[model samples]
Target chain A: MVQLTTDNSYGTWRFCAWNGMIFMGVFIVFWGIMGHNVPPYGGDMDASVIANYFRDNANLVRLGMAISMTFAVSYAVWGISIGKVMDYILGRDHILTNLQVWGAGLTVVPILVSSSFWLTGSYRPEALPDEILQLLYDMAWLLIDLAYSVTSVQMIALGVGCLRDKRAQPFFPKWVCWYSIWVGFMFVAEILMPMFKSGAFARQGILNFWIEFMIFFIYAPIITFYQLKAIKRIEAGEPAA
Target chain B: MSDEQSALQQSGRAPGDPGVWFFIIADMAMFAIFFLIFMAGRHEAPELYRASQAHLDSRFGLANTLILLTSGACMAKAVMMARAGDVAITLRYLLLTLGIGLLFGVSKVMEYGTKFAAGIAINTNEFFGYYFAFTGIHFLHWIIGCGVLTVLIRRVRRSGVNAENINWIESGGIYWHMVDLLWVMLFAMIYLLPPGGTA
Candidate 1:
């Protein structure tokens, strides 16, 4: 059994665990709130309307997207931390653990790339044509929504790994494991997003944006809570391997 | 029998892992939301929705419903037989369930073909959009359930039902039932419920 306590990396592990919350907070405030994407502009909104909003709020959008792009790395770092814990539960070379980290790492690409598109649109919204700005905005949403499977894989990998833990007391409870998988599966609804522009399947609509994204937000906090507890247990000299 | 297996036999205990229950409840809640959205859409353009919905062949939906229900019954029997250590009977029922599940998929594909042949599609109108989205999502669930059943069949074939493996069988059954339950609700809302009637 590996002695997790004397490993000298617990402090870093704990800090990385905290990154999950930090990523959620910064991403929500800057990417979601300040960027005016909490519900996002409607997919069916006219180009002029979308361009006008960006042009009108150029500075705020630039600030939000720029900061969002930077902090998005925190999500990957958080994944590494979770993957480390999973490594202890499974082996370091375990397929699921590798998948968990890889998924988390790849998930950053779309978020960062999408944020760049939004940032570029807002970079000089005054100089750009309405259609050009609208194209950038639509591209961003498409990239973000369509690339959701990576994050879903991360969630499922984590959930399945935790469920496989046969310790006397598992790292995460059964409900959280299943809930993580459920939230991951729920992202399938986003596949319909590009098809509908006005109804519930639209990017800004109720089901796609509100319910789908909200559950993810809820899932993050729950997983973080359990992870923090699991870290403490390991530090207290529980055998991780 | 192990304590876990003994507890499984108790009347008050739920079948499968508690985690699966969480999934089942969460899944039902999402479908509930989907149903609500469908109702809200139908309310916005009752005439259009009613007209589009009228084009659907209720017979197709009815046939799929019966097929899924039979599959669900077979899965339940499989779970029971597995618990009773009747590995041969369990495999038979599991195979039956898988066959019925395939029938549901085939029927759905044929129904989609009919719509396409008639110039109706997912993007035809608001009603068709909801129809395709709802049924499509449910179809994915059924496909996954079939996969789960396949695994259980393989497990029983290899080692039969032991204390360690029975929970997996029960959990797989629970998932299959959920697929059936969701379809029944889908059938009623999309097929049986006529426009301007609430019961």
Candidate 2:
């Protein structure tokens, strides 16, 4: 309930914007830190080419530190803005407890699965018997696909929430709401794309780089910046109604 | 459109949920890509991978898994307690979640610490590299979840936790559960398969 957001003057979402700018700073620093032996950014090498590089990066902590801190601090403010949006159209009746439980259950399980995935993602295929190699490949592949599928649902709900809420007019941007919905819809692409894993465009690791790079370099920062402006505006003055 | 869709469009409440989910999607996307990278990378060095993986310690992974399992339960209980409208009990469960979560962190730090001391730097090769990078990232998340719960507990005490405002707690719980879920995969990938240190 910060009535003090508008005070940032530069904008309500200033902090988030500032955070993004700084994060990009760190990301840029990534190149300098990773001098000389570069991963095949533009073209050919297998994706392992990149993984091994990061696998050998001086310290995982340094880069990770930059990502986690930026998001944590930025989201702290971001969450407040979300709370405000929720208050705007307070629901007539709380969502049924069952639905809430389902949501909570669905949400919780993925966290556990991902955590386990953390330890497991690193296993080298050579260690396992060469005999069952294909089986291992298939299993791991299927598991990841399943995990990604389930987790994507969480994002869909989020997108729906943004799309449905209109009072967010002054605070939340139309782009954010719509983009969220769009992203939710796009996750389906993963399922469909993999079905015909033979498609060169879909299989080529390069495509992932181009699309993901855009999200990181362009969309995330812009959206985060806008979010920061909204928060600052609400935090500085005239508590958001 | 259905009545539900029409009502949601008119009333801001339906769409007004905070941007946490949106932010979470971004984070999850990053993880997904890295995961894909890891899998594809391992596919290349199956021999070195299997050999290196055989050398890893599953016991630690299992123990860590147990700790996180308990923490997830604590997180769920914290939400239920807070919803029950008893400040004292809610605070207790929140504290429980925090303490258990911190223990998970400590265990991970110790796990990594022991590994490092034993000369298993991330770059020891792709196998060890992935070991550190993946688990290392998970460790980072556990720390964040702990910090979140710590702050949340303080907030619950200062401002009562009622149905109107309980989403905050639920959100944190959702995040903590994610931290736990990731561990399950981590164990299977890093410890169960390839035989990290075994023949």
Report i-RMS for every model.
0.6, 10.2
Q: Report clash pairs, candidate 1.
A: none
- The C-alpha stretches of model 2 lying farther than 4 A from their native spots are A1-170, A173-212, A220-241, B1-18, B195-199
Top DockQ model: 1
DockQ of each: 0.88, 0.02
Model 2 chain A weakest lDDT span, ten residues long: A34-43
lDDT of each: 0.88, 0.52
Q: What lDDT is obtained when candidate 2 is compared to the true structure?
A: 0.52
Clashes of each: 0, 67
